[model samples]
Target: MWLLIAVSVFVGFLIVLYLASPLITPKPLDLKGVHVLVTGGSSGIGKAIAVEVAQRGANICLLARNKAKLEEAQSEIEKVLVDKNQQKVIHISVDISKDYAAVVQAIQQAEEELGPVVLLVNCAGASVAGSFEDLSLNDFKRMIDINYIGTVHVTRAVIPSMKKNQHGRIVFISSQAGQIGLYGYTAYSGSKFALRGLAEALHMELKPYNVYVTLAFPPDTDTPGFAEEQKSKPEETRLISETAGLFQPSVVASSIIKDVVSGRFFSYAGLDGYMLAAVTCGMSPVTSIMEATQQVACMGIFRIISLFYLDHFDRICRKCKQERSDPSSEKKTS
Candidate 1:
């Protein structure tokens, strides 16, 4: 009798949770006729996101430091617009990491051309990988400048307008490295991880104004940036990253867009992404009761699984260290 009573109570609780989900869930944002500004949209995942939103009928503004690449991306995005005659795409050349006044000016130009930005995608970022001791101070500073402060500058410029409008969506394209610190990513991970703190605090301040924030944790992706990152990765970092595998830029962009429209606080790509998001969820805002329940139920199991992953990574680091210390090991293997 007690066992049956316990099961009945649990089922009743789930039913109540499901019915209450809508109260906390934000209405989905429509992309049609909306203005979206994508930083770093001249290439890679940023370009892919611009194409995705263009297909949804949003006017696009691409921001990057390279005027040539921005123009090239602008033309490509225009080709995918749902309304060729009505929809428009424009590009601005500016380094978001530098001068706040310049960022504000660039945003003004975009809003003047396209209208107030309904969505802002903070995708401009940089990565540098090396042992903590080997990395130059400039490397660390550059990563923070491009990945963290750049997002700050752009978001700061847009917030007042968004608040006045009382509706907006923001996306921060942080990497899987942002979720978990790994070998050779001391500088890169620190910068990416800073995004989460900013996103969380900003979400709180903006939620009352109906401005939603989505922080995306994308795994290793096949992009020009990813290719460059690979060149600087240590052997241990490479081995650990290979376990999750590389995803295409389109896939990552699509996932991010889906979450943004739904007003999800955390966005992730792939199985590994789902696991990390759940395990690290910790006090972050939830859009639905279902999401909260899943995190509650699965976090413990995912934490256990992560231990095995950590062990494997530790083994890789030890092996790499051994090979480096004993030069003869390379000859023996050959």
Candidate 2:
């Protein structure tokens, strides 16, 4: 009984330490005069981020495959410029996924017009949803090409310039699905998961050069692309995903930019994202003292709670399979 009391007191002391230590986060990087490049900047989260950065005095370059859309996005972003006297917003038309040379050329042109890109945001991506068995090889390849390879193409083009300057910020917009693979995301999940691995490796490689890397794991946001993806998503996928609340692009983009500016390696959106990042902290570098303390103290409890979530998802999948196998199974079982 005396030992139990001692243990409880010790645990309480640790909890207090975790709660109180270093609530302050690092100061965010100044955006004034920084040359910022955003891929897939024509719409959705990318467009939102571009608008936010532009409001902060960053020189903005928006890249997408559609000239018309890029023009429209640039117009929107330009309206938010912190100073009307700064250089005009730049827009490029090129498919980053299929043409690495073209992407590189576009970056060169943007740099010439604006300045060397000190901040690069990789947001050009797409998703294809279906069961693993139902998805075609082309489906998998397309997702990988746009979501994974597209990020590579843009990042590679900007790296040399960043390395030359020895200071830069690279942000990759991954998905919550990247952290925890869910049903009907076989191809899409794989592509997003690849982003996490790339970001982690890049974070290690770029840190010494004063370049920071951030991977954003945003939950479902209200975006045009997300709406399109919903059309192809399996019923089970939609059902499972509905549990996590959908967020606005502006909200997500705001959180991402805030984290990126602070030089954080992982940028999570909303409470779901916070929980997911905390549970999956693993070997990822922790920049926030409070975040590190939370992970150290609560990971085990979160894991236990996560098992219930996994079991719920598993049950949903099983039920869906059963219903498909025998349409009358529900009635019969009841």
Candidate 3:
């Protein structure tokens, strides 16, 4: 059929475009002497990212709630600095969700000590998983405060400097849960999903200023925060989430940094992460022509593939609910 031939031609064209993507990669920004501010940079993926950028010659300012942990992270990053003279590391403690004034003060102090923050990484976030009815209104509010508003506070503090400089990189650490809603993640997913909208709008608004925005969708990274989240996950949530395998924080941090430097709007780690991003490319901006071509070509196929995943997840939730309702079935399993 003519339709079949058209589809084949489109697929071939897209394959060629994807292969040429690297050739069309955006010009990478120089990080040497760049002032990089990372929120929640005391541990986990945030700490790992701080170490990476530090090694690349960016002065690092780590912000977190725990002074002791931030100090410890600062020490660790100091050990890996490529040039002691080129980059320095410092730590500040503030609860970004509640301390808007303190966050502004910390940024001012960091700018005076280091320089204006050329790169801002919003990595501070919190997650709580439970059935919707079981999660209190406070839980939802807390998730929004810590995950969404915290990002806004740091970003707002840094934007003026970046606008004045006329160049910057702002990275937001959003999870795969942000892209898709999973069971028992009502509060967490809502907060993460909000970042996508924020990042997208900023991308369009900041383009003229040459300030790039990157939203990273890291899947189930093996971080201290993730370990803590596991303790609170419902059985159904755990079973559904396990399908997306855990990744090391270093691997994820590296991938995200690569995307940031490349001026990618959406940064994803691992095969599943890439597939998810591609499949859900919907209205997201594409930095490269090749990327746009690939998304247009692959969207339909990936959507078909995603149905299988959705079915599996739905099946798990239904099975768990059924078990909970049937006392005899639950006892037998126990």
Candidate 4:
């Protein structure tokens, strides 16, 4: 029994390594001389991806709502430059709510000015945290409008030009909650879940045409948007967020850029997020079930395991505080 268990563990790890290897990498999304567009480039993960791609010598077209913020982001992108010969970036301010056709026009204009947009990042999104009962129809619609429909709008406009050029990369910055739904994330997760389905279907349709699509599952990114959501979240959601340390947008951006350049369909940004995705990818889920009892270590069980590690750091901090305050503990150290 022990030998069988060891064999299974070794096999599982090998399979993971095989799938994660970049040898399967396709054409690079390195935008050298190519143009790229990222919605929500005013700040956060979208902005980070913009910077990273710009550094690679791509001419950029920034998209967002605030004119001042877009200009500011363009300035920041310019500050990183070593010379004028390297490709530069441009800004176009538009609300992605698809509330205005002007947003679509702006994207087209960008493609015309910068050259066919070879990369698109649909990172503009929002989350409304509340009990299912507390959320209204309008709340749900708003989440859908900005998160899902907005994605459709952008992809619809961007792909036609990409098809004409026979090349492009489209990325959707989904969340872990989209994969494993949460108690208070019904609305947010719904939009992200739908986004994943769209990305999958789009990938199959476009692979023949050389256009690549990637859906990134990032867990609880440390963005200003998330900070704002935390201020009014339910206690249960807040506890969950605290356990899942807010991930940096740069981490998300870097991982996504690698996958995009490599023509991979999926990328996971958070440690726990990637682990969960790994388990999902390997549906047989080996070495998890007790061999003798045959008790299945299901998805729910795996999630609880993630929660345990997610809260470990916080628990250690609390333990250290208690130990420092206890006089007996101090004497033991001394």
Q: Estimate the overall C-alpha local distance difference test score of candidate 4.
A: 0.76
Q: Tell me the tens digit of each residue's lDDT in model 1 across 24-91.
A: 77789999999999999998999999999999999999999999899899999989888999999999
Task: For model 1, state the Cα shift of residue 56 in Å.
Answer: 0.4
- Please give, for residues 112-216, the per-residue lDDT of candidate 2 as tens digits: 998899899999998888999999999999989999999999999999989999889999999999999999999999999999899999888887777888899
Clashing pairs in 3: none
- Models ranked on TM-score: 1, 3, 2, 4
RMSD of every candidate to native, in Å, equals 1.8, 3.6, 3.3, 8.0
Q: Evaluate all candidate structures by whole-model CA lDDT and list the values in order.
A: 0.92, 0.89, 0.90, 0.76
Instruction: Give the winner by TM-score: 2 or 3.
Output: 3
lDDT assessment of candidate 1: 0.92
Please give the lDDT score at residue 248 for candidate 1.
95
Question: Model 2, residue 192: displacement in angstroms?
Answer: 0.8
Candidate 1 — which residues are off by over 4 angstroms? Answer: 8-23, 330-334
Models 1 onward score TM values of 0.96, 0.91, 0.92, 0.78
Q: What's the true lDDT of residue 10 in model 2?
A: 67
TM-score of 3: 0.92
lDDT ranking from best candidate downward = 1, 3, 2, 4
